[model samples]
Each structure stands twice: as structure tokens, then as C-alpha cells.
Target: MEFIARATAVVGGAVALVRRIGAPGHQAMGPSPQIPEAKAQGIMTLKMPVARGWKEGHVPTCAPGLAVNAFATGLDHPRWIEVLPNGDVLVAESKEQAGPPRTLMDHAAQATMRRAKAIGDSANRVTLLRDANGDGVAEVQEVFVQDQNQPFGMALIGDRFYLGNTDGIVVFDYTPGATSLTGAGRKLVSFKPHGHWTRSLIASPDGTKVYAGVGSLSNIGDMGMEAEEGRAAIWELDVASEKARIFASGLRNAVGMAWEPATGTLWTVVNERDGLGDETPPDYLTSVRDGGFYGWPYSYWGGTVDDRVKQDPALVARAITPDYALGGHTASLGLCWMPAGTLPGFGEGMVIGQHGSWNRSKLSGYKLIFVPFANGAPAGPPRDILTGFLSPDEKLAYGRPVGVVVGADGRSLLMADDVGDVIWRVTGA
Candidate 1:
């Protein structure tokens, strides 16, 4: 492990000198903008911001007319957030299970994970936070669910609660205001795990079906395409039948998903392929189509072919372009829509939690951003909603924002800060 880590460090340093250049951050965003040509690198770029964490009485910076505070603190690594019907928030305190490296790339990936503070024992639990009396803090906390395998996404339908474990979907009977789950959950379906284990879950508008976003087994099919079956795609499952099928394909890593309020269309924020320089193949947000392919392995950003993979002209031709580009190597993950008139200045649009970059020379996307929407599509450039996750020097990150969701009252935003192990609440000042 030591030898592999040292070798990767040496190779990464060499790769950084030849990093690809492209459009500036702002020019790469919005409905229509420039997408620079991709420049593939032989070795993956390895630039991770060190985790410094926040000091006492400190929190992330909020945009004008807003205030930020810690809602819950001193918890395990909280990655995803789910707001229940009764205004209680459920936080998935999770981390990837550490295992032996299988290859040189695996060693490099593990080193990156350590630098990003992503390597740790899975918490395998969800904690409930109640901010009663509208105090902007979680005064009451309880263990809502426990003993799971790296739980990420969560959804509730009628009396059924669903959790997207790294390897499968589990179902439990839910009751309003319940403090903890005692009954053993039944497995709804199993998934092929190993690579990109975060399975983000969302329910259909009508509550009859559920969607699970399973990421690819390797970057650009490095492990052969056969290992990628049912991966890098969204699986649609019928609640009654326990049947599942791929809803959409070629999404490298759809970590966060939401329903656009205006058109009732499903949308997702995808983490695009890395190692293709700092500015190629921008991570994106788009409205997910029922049977659409968004380009992966064979190509990216619609028909822009990645020369590294074997050519598939037919697949590339059918690939659907994303709605908006977040930025290259931003590692954009969390997605949620705020209703119109919910917050001043920030009207109807989607809020994304950019977990930040580990492979970019200059850091990008450690903050939470709001992308304005008009008629159910991205209308303007994304605006910063929360900032200062990184230090002024940019060498260290105090925290990395992950899952985000509008408060149950619709007047504020709640974000999960995994590096700091806190849930931050952003509200109108």
C-alpha cells in the first residue's frame, strides 16, 4: 500500500503539469454555454483539498439576506438528508467501508479517498433531528434507523420507508413521528456493488414507483463492460411487483435527484467521468427521460466521443445532451428544487451540493449553489447560496457540502456537511 501510494503521488504530480485547459467556470454553466474540447490524460489527476474542519462558533457563509447555523453537530459522516412529513429531518451518517486495494488505480483512488476524508468505516445509520419551536436548531436527536451497509438515499411512500443501501434497497414500515425503527426491514432488491456505491433514491410523483441511481463499476469501463450491467443508470422499480428496469442509461454517477415542480419532471445532478483533464466533460444537471441514454464510456456531453473507449457510433448518436453544465471536475452531487416564492432573490430553481473536486488543479464546487429555473428549465447562471467550505488559502477545506433539501416549512435550506459531521441550516435573515 505504501509503495502504491508513493507511486501514485509521483505520477499525479507529473500529470498535474500537463493538465488540460478549457472554458472559465462561469462560461461553462447555464442553459447554453461553451463546452471546451476534452483532453484526455494518461494518468488520473490527483489534487485533493485537505480537510481542516470548522472551529467552534464558525459556520459556512451564506448569501445576502440569509443566515447560516448548525442544526445538528458532532455526528458521524452525514452524507444525505431526507425531510419527513412531520418536519423531522433524517440524516444518513455514512462512509465507505475500507478494503484492500486490488490494483494500482484502486490504490490511487484509495489515496484520493483518504485525502478527501472519504475513507472510513460505514456508520450505517440514520439520525432524526427535530427543530421544534422553529429555533433553527435540532434540539432533539434520536437514532432513527441503524445497522445498514452504507445507506445513502432515502424515500417514504404511504407507510413504507425505503433506504438505498450500497448493495440493495430495503423497505420498512414507517409511522409518523417515530423515533426509531425496530422491525427488521425486508430486502426489496439487490444491486451489484463494488464501485460507485452511493445509490441515490427517489419516489415517483404518484408514489407507485421508485427510482434508484446506481453508478458505474469503473471509470470509463476500465473493468470491462460486463461488470457495468445495471450500473451508470437509473433503475425504476414498481412498489407492488418488486420488479425493476433501467429507466435511463449512461449517467456516470447520478448521486442526487429531484422532481421539478413546474413540469413534474424528474431531474438529476450527475458526477461526470474524471481523469479527462480539469475542464473536459463537465458534470451536469438535466431532466431525466424515461428511456434516455446520456452518454458514458463510449462518449460524453451528447455525441462528443471519448477516444479512450471503443467507438459505438449508434450509442453516441442516441445520447441525449444534458440540460445545463455545472462545471468540469466539480463533483456536483446533491439536487433539490425549492418552490417559487420560498426564499427571496432565490425563487423557483434547484439547489445543488457540490461535494467539491479532488482532481482539479484549482478547487471548484465546495459550496452550495442555486440555479434559477423558468418553465421547468434552467433559466440563468447558477448563484452561490452557501460558500466558505474551503479556507481562504484554498489548500484546506473546512467542510464539504453533500445532500441538500429545503426545510419542511419551505422557508429555509438544510445541508449536510460531511467533513465537519454537521447539518447546516440556511434561512432568511
Candidate 2:
């Protein structure tokens, strides 16, 4: 029975690919995206690319007037990045935990990840890179912390260091300019582990609190809504007492977050649920408000009900429409604030590292982008900051950009390329 179901899904996917019938990618972008009705296939549209590492002396193509280089190379699946006050770069090297393939769709998903070089035993460590002389490339590289459970985000407030492991947030005592963490550290707060297990962390500008993004347990509550009790929401933690609460609810997968400077508003890039059609509901970038709800399983894009789930009209009525759409399945992760003069011609904006798509017929994202901001709102269309991560044929991928941050020098941009196993630095030409 499982084999028959799998075979049927494969044939259906092939036929859909041949027809090439889907919404145009550009039509589902920016502030006002053209969202169509739901077109849920029995199985997902899988277009996984084979991972091919960068060739010697070759790198992702930067936008004109910008140059890029491998700041540090040969790391093990680097996924997220953080910079310390002393100009030291910390990278979290990790991978998702593999579970048993229970359903035909799960089997197909596993195969897709295997081909994409995304499934493996995690490195489970955080590494430090330093460019001592202010050159673009790092002269010192060393493992800063190890034996972690898929660590993704790192923050340092005063002398206390916070690490966002998959199951919980761990706090460590640290000394400035130290090379590595020798202490075992204790868990500050616990979170349910496994499903959508990237716990991304950011500290308040005042260094008094921390925010963490936790994703849903399944697509649209397939695992039962009760199982998703504390998932799919951003959490706020008080540094002194370690008390935590949900900051915002109904974000399916809010991986990357940043604070808007002008308004001090918290903003995030959320990856919406899959299995819907190519453009049923676009992934979005939005300002996260306290006690607010953005639709997930019950609805999306402001009360557009997903009929697949049990209807809840009351929750749907309160669903907040996102500020801007980033196109469907773009997997817009790794967000950071970019000040006006940080990268030459670019104005104040947000830098987004899109990890690209696996659940769409045609690929989306696969590059770094910048959304210009004016008066604390998105002012213009997204601009490509780096391109060519995917080959022209779109079958081979050189890299997937994750966790982006302004370099310690405040002029260059640093991005983590997990598939390529390198950290790329971008600066004015």
C-alpha cells in the first residue's frame, strides 16, 4: 500500500512538472502579492537540487559594485553566525535530526534531503573566526564550543553567553577575548525538541532580554494542535530571572528576526506551511507585535481560511495580515539590519539570506536579498545582493546562504554558506 501511494505521488509530480502550471514567481511578491486559491496536491512538489561544492577560486556572484570572498572555508555545515564586541565571529555548525520515515511523503522528503546534502550527523559545535589585522579573510579559526544539540543561535549579554540549542536555551559564563567555552553551562529554559528545531536567538538592544523563534511540529497541525503547545511562536526570556513567555503566536517557522532601528519594532521573516500550491500563500516579512496572531493552520494572509484544517472562524477573524510577501517557499531565513552606509549604494534596509525552495516546481530564493526601508516600512522591491548560488540549469546548487550578519568591521557583510562549507564576506568594490 505504501509503495502504491509513493508511486502514485511520483507520477503525479512528474505530470505537474511537465505541465509547468503554477503562479509566476514575481506575481507573488512584495507588499501586495496575488495569492490564488489553495491547490493542495496529495504530495508535495519536490525539486531538490544536488549539492555541488564551490570550485577552487570560484564564489557566488555578487551584485555589481560589490565584491565577495571566502572569509573562512572548510567548516562543517555552518548554519548561523554571530559576532562579539571584540570583533570575533562565532558560527554554529549543525544539521537537523533525522527521524524515521513513517509516511510515503516522509520517504519522499527524506530522499530529497539526501540528494540535497542536507541530511547528516550534525557537527554540533560553534566555531570562532577572527580577522586580527582587519583584512577581509580570517587568520584565526578555532572551535569555541562543542557537544551541543544542533545549536543555531548565539548571543552574549555582558559576561553571560546564551546558546539556543534545539531542546533549550543554555547560558554560560564567559570572559571577554576568551578562545573557547570550557564550562558545561546550565539550561536556562526548555523547549520541545525535534520538529522544526532551529531555535534562533537575539538579545534586546539594551541587553536585558532575549527572543527565540520556535517552529511548528507539523505542517498545519497534522500532528494534532495539542502537540504544538509551545511551538510555532517567538519566546521572550527575562535575563535576570529566566522567566519566559510567548512573544508572538501563529508564525509557522520564524527563523530569522531583527529589530527595526527607527521604530524599535521587532521584525521577522517567516516560512509558511507547505503542501499548498505554488502560490496559495506567500511567505512573508512582517513586524511582530506583542499579543498578536498571524495565521498558521487555521488561516493565512488575513483570514484566508485553509479548508484542510478544522475551521475556527474566531481565530481567523483576528489573524494579522503580513506586511510584505517574499514569494512562496523561498525559505527566507537569516535576517539582519543593514544601516544606510553599511554596503555603499544600499540604503537602510534588511538583508535576507534565502535558502531557496524544495517544495515548488520552479525554484525561488537561492540568493541573498535586500529590502530597502524608509520610515520604518519597506520602501521598495527587494534587490539581489548575491546571485548564482544555483546553476543556470537549476539542477546543481553551489551553496545555500543562511544566517547573515554585518561583519565586525561594520562595512562588510558575512554570510554562512552551509552546503559550500564556507563563510562569504561581501564589501564595496
Task: Enumerate residue pairs that collide in model 2.
Answer: none
Across 186-249, the per-residue lDDT of candidate 2 in tens digits comes to 9988999887889999999998899999999898999899999998999999998889999999
TM value for model 2? 0.96
Candidates' lDDT values, in order? Answer: 0.86, 0.89
- Specify the highest-TM-score model's number: 2
> What TM-score number comes out for model 1?
0.95
Model 1 lDDT tens row, 1-429: 556555665676556645534424443676565777676666667866667789998889889988888999988989999999999999999897767788677789787677667886788999999989888889999999999989999999998999999999999999888888779999988998767889999999899999999999888998789899889999999998999899999999999999997789999999888876666778999999999999998888888899989888999999999999998878888889888777777888999999998776666899999999888899888899999999876667899999999999889899999999999988888
Cα misplacement distance, residue 319 of candidate 2 (Å): 0.7
Error in Å for residue 155 of model 1:
0.5
The C-alpha local distance difference test score for the whole of candidate 2 amounts to 0.89
Off by over 4 Å in 2: 1-16
lDDT of 2 at 17: 82
Candidate 1, clashing residue pairs? none
TM-score for each prediction? 0.95, 0.96
